[model samples]
Target: MSKVSETTLEIDLRALEHNFRYLKSKLGAETKLLAVVKAFAYGSDMVSVSKKLEGLGVDYFAVAYVKEGVLLRDAGIRTPILVLHPQAVNFDTLIERFLEPSLYSPRILKEFLKVAEAKNQKKYPVHIKFNTGLNRLGFWENDVDWILKHLNGTNAIKIKSIFSHLAASEDENEKDFSLKQIKSFKKSSSELAEKIGYQPIRHMLNTSGILNYTEAQFEMVRSGIGLYGYANDAQIDSELKPVASLKSIISQIHKIEPNESVGYNRAYKSDGYRVIATLPLGHADGIGRHYGGGNTMVLLNGKLVPIIGNVCMDMIMIDVTGADCKEGDEVIIFGGNHSAEDFANSAQTISYEILTAISQRVTRKIKE
Candidate 1:
């Protein structure tokens, strides 16, 4: 493919397919897969990723909001989309777009029922979220009876699925806690099913959950980061391909002398004569301020060079003293052997933040 600009996020669609196939291999033939395309397919390209997955016969797509689902629907994605979190005001739009809402609270459930009834809708598929341990969203286990009571005579909507989140599926230290969450989800789902007269799909696994808690994989599974090629485990990480490669080119080269300060607030001071290369991309492109001033480095011609100055809004300076590279050479911010996980480790963060932090302004080119 041709380069579009100085900086671009090269999204390898083939790697995405590989990751999807790998994840699929872990499941049974009956298990449904819901590819989470929230946050622009975890900061790749939502429309492009969803379109490819749809062609691959993915069972469902998920987004964090109703607008995102609508975007996919408008883009001709015929698969069912689950909005992980839908606001009360967007209930009408959700219904209009045929997007399924994850009802986490009693308020959201009641409000959605009101709107669905007003629209004269019937059997609208809505997922129920139970607060197993995430505590972030979802109805409490004790509130199951209340939910059943409210839905007893309602014809507005029907349950499509019951799900919860794994608080620490990737953390071995919290395996017991994760197991407890699974137990709670199973019990709560069963109780709700008994009251509702039929069981909807039950799923409570994210990517790591799918790997670590395979027994808990219910009727369906949601793959988020795994679909984009991350497992939060070293062995599993090695098996997955890094899909997004953030690359740029050295815009200019500079020679700095002793005791010279660099960038905003003089965050970096040169001790001696040094060579620096400036790249025409910065925090505005998702390299945050925390990644500034020697915290991280970029790959220049396969050599890692320290970022020697505060990350500018539109640029960053790197120390390339001994590196055999010059202006116009390709600079890889993160990709290939220089993995996003390793890059994120330099900033004391996770791969998800680093990958998703990639700004939308960066042109995404699909790579085969």
Candidate 2:
């Protein structure tokens, strides 16, 4: 635990290890585990999280951009890193850092191949993404021949792996759709390999796919939100421990009279005498306006206090009339008994949005 007076996003490495082990337990001994460390490892410290995952012998790491991969490489992360959505402009940096890029379209592939050829590169590793069903940033099934034709004579790069995203693997009602996606990915990957002369590693399972569709585990698996302590399922949620806890101190306390408004635009009005505590965190810190006006609550001294005002850029007021808490008491925005999932649900959003939305300015203290 950190000092109650300072706002901090505590990253518990132990809990992170627990989640990693839990996710790994679902895979076979030979299955490669690629930890998704993009968006700052889901808004926790990316370098710190990658350091721990590296120590745990994670097979690979994935990030959305080349800069993120560069950050990891600069920090001496030796684990093989895959750039999920690489841009052509950074191909030089990508090659320079030994970062593998997921070339999803012909334009990207052609552009990168040209760069690799100019650099006199041989057998550069590049992953290919197919649009199984996600219909996002991937080569369509019909584009298989076009891709093969483009790469037929290129010695500059080799297919490192073939993968696709599952659009609805987490929803039970969408199981059929997920299965269809897996089928499509398998067919596409196989056909491409047959045409390209070698079987690159094939993977289509995301975190939920690992749990719900184990048969399609392929040769590798990607654990993104799962590594951050969420599976989007109640059973899995119970077995995993969240790694980050956002906490802040009550900066001030006030007693409000009847009809007294709190925050901008008089969003919340006291019906009678009420006590309010202001926390030094608000929308700027990831506690968005959707969390204000009693839509969400924070844990203070084991009591839940409703947010009672419009969320400001740097402050939020919470009604704490019945609690024995005082100024300087620690308030838990999310984590522990108050899960991030619960808070996100209260805000009518998902855990991914809430976790990734955390502002970088908040001090992240890692706990061993």
Candidate 3:
């Protein structure tokens, strides 16, 4: 990999492959792997990430919206794509692109059926999303009867899989709750399979669930953060390599005298002599304002430096006082030893937020 010349997000494809294989080792031999590549592959260039995953032999791909699936299709991704949240308005385009939709509600089911029937789609693949405990977008267990009734005479669409989400698979304190959710999903999916006279693939594990609940591996498993190299657990995180490395070069260096204010609203007032280094990326580049005022620390020349003053729209200043660093020095916002999880922890957030918050404007350099 080349040294950081500017603010760039370096995506290591080898690290992604390592993470994928690591997560796969946790599943049964026959269990399928569905890679979630929504939100620009969690803010690291969705098209590139999806391409690599497809090459890695991922069984399926999942996205949050119809457009995301379309993007994969446009990129020549041939793997089956499941749209996790399909709106009624995009049913036509979704089917047109052969993107599978996760039908979570009666209205959405009916709307998709109408589109499928109108388009003369026979046995168009679709997944049924059940709300085991997430209380999010999914059909209730009671909705099974209604779903069966609606599908009694339809040949336009077919259920490809029945799945649910685990609320707290990463928290040991919530182990009982996770188990109950898993049990509920099993019961509901079994009931639906018996009534529907067919068994669709059953899956209900995310990245954390994959790590903590191997028994509930069902027929398939979905992984998002795990592929990006995070398991929400410190011990597990050590086993996975982060694929995205946020790196920037010091744009400039300044010497602040005593009582000298820096940045907007005079957020940082130097008490004595200090050295501050300005980085090109700021709030607009996905480093939010909340990370300002010394809340977040960045690595400069192998030393951790707190971000001083308010984050500018396109720049941020970090205290580099007494550091053996100069202008053009590389700064690691998060990656390698200090993972995105570590970075987000400093701001009372999670790896998901920081990873996905990275702006698309940041140059993405794929490390093959």
The most accurate candidate by lDDT is: 3
**Local distance difference test values of all predictions, in order:** 0.90, 0.92, 0.93
Deviating ranges (above 4 Å) for candidate 3: none
lDDT of 3 by residue, 68-149 (tens): 9999999999999999998999999998899999999999999999999999999999999999888988998899999998
lDDT (Cα) of model 2: 0.92
* Full candidate order by lDDT, most accurate first: 3, 2, 1
After superposition, the stretches of candidate 2 with alpha carbons farther than 4 Å from their true spots are none
C-alpha lDDT of residue 336 in model 3: 96
Displacement of the residue 161 alpha carbon in candidate 3, Å: 0.4
TM-scores for every predicted model: 0.98, 0.99, 0.99
Model 3 lDDT on a 0 to 1 scale: 0.93
- lDDT of candidate 1? 0.90
**How many clashing residue pairs are found in candidate 1?**
0
Q: How many residue pairs collide in each prediction?
A: 0, 0, 0
Q: Which ten contiguous residues of candidate 1 have the minimum total lDDT?
A: 1-10
- RMSD to true structure for each model, in Å: 1.1, 0.9, 0.8
